[model samples]
Target chain A: MSALIDLFSVAAIGAGLFFFFAGTVGLLRFPDSLTRLHALSKADNLGLGLVVLGLIPRAENPLAALKLLVVWALVLLSGASTAQLIGRALRRGRK
Target chain B: MSVLPALDVGLALLVVGVAAWTIAARNLFASVVGYVAYGLLLALVWVRLYAPDVALTEAAVGGGVTGVLLVTAGKRLDALASAEVGVPPGRALKILAGALAALVAGALAWVVLTLPSPAPSLAPAAAEAAAGPGAGLGNPITAVLISYRSFDTMLEKVVLILAVLGVWSVGADAAWGAAPAPLRKVRPDGAMILLAQFLAPVGLLIGVHIFWVGADAPGGAFQGGALLAAMGMVAMMARLAEPPRIDSRKLRLALVAGPAVFLIVGVAGLALADNLFAYPQNFAKPLILFIEAFMVLSIAVALPMLVCGPPNGSPK
Candidate 1:
């Protein structure tokens, strides 16, 4: 049972690492600010969510797992809003 | 080659890399973003050092609140389209400054590497206070802040109040009592407003939970109050709420309440206990918690005021 859980954790965390790597590449390679923001928001948000989920089963307690979830949620909220705000500013600047 | 050690080595390298990027990034906004990343990375360093309380503060205040403050300043500067005004430094001066900075960094690194074994720390003293008569607080950081060194913490609160006043002093005489300009964007996006509306209540709850749990856990007044302040700034930015008026009595009261209560308790302690800041044996825990409650409120108010600065031309 423990071995199975460990394998699951590794797979989930590995997927998260992949998204993070993808996000960085997209950030550097994307042609424009809006597209870059899109890449970052999507990749980073899902990456963090998966990482948090993978760690939950390893948490010492249920509350600790929930706290991890809350951290991811807060980051998600902030990242989404930040990307939108920047996108709006970008369009306005060109106008 | 344990996983933990490898993670720590990678984190240290990442922190150094980001710190260098923060200083070297060509654009102001990029530099500020790098700084935010650096702050977050430093929080991880703090965690690795077995200082979760410090980690929370580093992440919330160092990274989160400071990031918002700088981004706001960057936006305002971008608006003015200000030309680069400073004289370009000659190569000789730049080299001298770089060499000096490198020397200082090397010295700091050497000190860390050669530190006395076992770290000659005050941990034992802090541990005694944590478990002893100093409020029976489980978290040593809170015990030291609220019980052992309450005076220093009280003074820190006063410093925050002074900062608020200093910002207020810079406003034009006619702008007193006026609301600061709205923090909204040129054309606020609908999605952000929805996010703020959903996030603010949840953030506020977590903020209070952090404050409440500080007595027993890694969270504390500073971390919780910063979260509260972050929520307020978000709501203001989303155009969901107006900034409080400068001359409002309630605003002034909340601003001073933390330090004021802390001071009152310290004065009362002289008569009620062995010395100033000493809570009578049975009442220690309750008194400390009472003071912390007010400190959180005051911190929540003071940080937003600092971020917002003083009142603008008219009430919004």
Candidate 2:
């Protein structure tokens, strides 16, 4: 059971890391503000979500697992909102 | 053999790189962003050193509140347009400043290196007291902050109140009793309003929980209160609430409540216990928590007020 859990955790975390790397590359290489933000918000959120999912199974207790989820949720909420706000500001500045 | 050392080295390098960027960044706003990132990275270093309490403090005040304060100041300066970019220092001045910085760093390094083989520490004494007379709090940091150093804690709250007063006293006489300028001049759109609505309550809950768990955990009143203040700022930014009038009775009351309650308790302690700040043996935990609750309230109000600065808006 532990071996199976570890395998799943490692696989999920690897996938998450790939997305994070992709997000960083996009953020650095994207030509425009909106596109960079698009790469960042979408890719990073999925990356963090996957990482959280991977870690939850290894949490010491149910509360710890729940706390991990809460962290991800809060990050997602803030990320999405800030991305929208930033995009709006960018549009306004161009105008 | 272990990757931990490499990770630590990398973290230290990252912190230094960010700090250097913060110093060297040409744009004021970019420097502030670098500063914020530097603070967060320093907080991570603190965590690696097994100092979660300090880490929380660094992350909240150093990164979060200070970032907001600086960004707000920068925005105001930009809006005023009177803030001319100052001329850069000449080569001689730059070299002199570098020499001075190097001298300070070298002196610090010398002092640290010349310390006795077994450096003095109060950890043993603190541990003894914390496990015995210091109210048996599970978290040694809390015990030190509240039980062992109650006077310092109370005075710290007083200092915050004093800071708020100091900020207020700078206002023009006409702006007295008025609110500070709104944090956001632009009307917040739907997304911001929704973020504030969804996040504030959850943040408040987490803040309280952080404070509540402080007796046995890494969280504390300052960290929790900082989070609460951040939430309040978010609400203000989203136009869900306005910064209160400086002279509002309720606002004044909240500002002073923490230190006032703490002082009153300390005075009462002289009668209840032998020392000025001592709690009775049986009631220490409850009293500490009670005092901390008020401290949290005061901190939450004081920080946001500090960021808002002296009142600038006309009286409502």
Candidate 3:
């Protein structure tokens, strides 16, 4: 049972890391601000979500796991809102 | 090879790179962003050094509050469009500055390298005090700040008040006692309003939690207060609230409450305890918490006021 959980954790975290790497690449390679923001917001949020999912089982307690989920949720909220704000600023600048 | 050393090396390199970028960035805003990043990275370094209190402080005040303050200043400067953009330093001045920096760096490096093999530390004594007859607090950092170094801590709050007054002193005479300008000149869109509405309450809860836990844990008044200040600033930025008038009695009271209560307690100590700043036995923790509660209030108020700058025009 423990071995299975470890394997699942490793696979999830590895996948999360790949997404993070892809997000960074997109941030650097995207042609414009809006597109880069899109890449970053979407990929990094998913990356973080996956990372949190993987770490939940390894948490020392249920509260710690909940805390991990809370952190991921906070990040998602802030990231999405910040992206919107940045996009609005970009649009205003263009105008 | 152990991964820890590699991680340390990488962090060190990253910190230096970010510091260099902060100094080298051509755009003021970009430099400010780099500076905030550097502060956060430095907080990580503090954490690695096993100083979670300092880490929280560095992340909150150094990175978060300072970032907002600089960005506001930059915006004001851009609005002014004064000739103060002025001249860049000459090559001779730059070289002189570089030489001075190098000299200071060399001196610091030499001092660090020549330190005693077994570094001198007061940790054992502090721990004894914390765990025994002293404050009996679980966190030595809190004990030291609130009890052992109470005078210094109280004075630090006084210094914050002084700093706020200093910021206020530069305002126009007509604007005296008036509220500072709104933090955001631009009307924030719906998304920012939503973000502030949602985040502020959550941040406030976390801030208070951090402060409340400081008595026995890694969090403390400064960290919590800084977080509170950031949340307040966010609300102001979203146009949910405005900076209070400087002359408001309630506002002034809140600002000075921390240092005042701390001083009163210190004075009372002369009668109640042996030393001027000593807390009486058996009641140290409660007294410390009482003082800390006020200190937290003062810090939370003072920081945002400092960021808001001196009063702009007359009151609305």
Candidate 4:
């Protein structure tokens, strides 16, 4: 049972790491502001979520596990909204 | 060799790389962003050193709040900078400055590498008071702040309040009671407004929780109060709320409340406990908690006000 959980955790963490790598690649290669923002927001959110999920089982208590989820959720909310705001700013600057 | 040491080496390298980039970045805004990244990396370094309380402080004030301040200042200065005369320094001067900077960096690295092994630690003293005293706090840092070295903490609060006063006085005489300009962008930003509303409640709760848990954990008034101040800044930036006028009675009261309460408690200590800031053994925990709660309130208000700068002058 513990081996299975460990395997799952590693897979989740690996996938999350890949997402971060992809996000960095996109940030460098993306042609424009909006696309770059899109790449980062989407990739980083999923990356953070997976990382949080992977680590949750390792938490000493249920509250600690729950707090991990809250951190991910908060990041998602802030990231999406910030991307939107940045996109708007980019538009205005171009105009 | 364990993975941890390797990770630490990588982290240190990353921090140094970012610091170099931040210094070298040509654009002011880009440099500020790089500096923010540097601060975040430094926070990780602090965490790895088994100082999560310091890490929290670094991330909140050093990275988050300072990032906002620098970026905002950079934006305001951009237009002025572009209009000013441009003068490029000779290569000889640049080379000389670079040599001096390298010398300083080398000296710092040498100091860190040669730090005495079996580090001179005050852990024994800190832990003895924290555990032996009936303070009953789990965090040694909190015990040090409020129980052992509390007068220093009170005086630091005084310094913060004085700094805020200095910032306020920079405004023109006619603008004393006027509200400072808000941090919002030119457009009516719907996304920012929605974000502020969504995050502010959660952030405020977390801030309070950080303060509450601080008695036993890594979180504390400084970290939690910074979070609250950030929430306030987010609200102001989204145009959801205006900066309060500098002369508001209630605002001034809140600003002074922490230090005042702390000072009063200290004086009372002089009479009751025979020394300033020394609480009665039985009542120490509650008194510390009471002091901390007010400290959070004052810090949360004062920091954001400091970041907002002063009210706009009549004719700048």
CAPRI band of model 1? medium
Candidate 1 chain B: minimum summed lDDT over ten consecutive residues — where?
B79-88
The global C-alpha lDDT for each of the candidates, from Candidate 1 onward, is 0.87, 0.90, 0.90, 0.87
Tell me chain A's TM-score in each of the predictions.
Answer: 0.97, 0.97, 0.97, 0.95
Residue A64, model 2: Cα distance from true site in angstroms: 1.4
Candidate 3 local lDDT, residue A84: 92
Interface RMSD of each: 1.2, 0.3, 0.5, 0.5
Better of 2 and 3 by lDDT: 3
TM-score of each: 0.89, 0.96, 0.96, 0.91
Error of 3 at B151 (Å): 1.2
Off by over 4 Å in 2: B91-96
Residues B184-208, candidate 1: write the lDDT tens digits: 6454688778888999999899899
Model 3 chain A: weakest 10-residue lDDT segment is: A38-47
Tell me the TM-score of chain B in each candidate: 0.91, 0.94, 0.95, 0.89
Model 1 has fnat of: 0.64
Number of clashes recorded per candidate: 0, 0, 0, 0
CA deviation > 4 Å runs, candidate 1: B78-83, B89-121, B185-187, B314-316
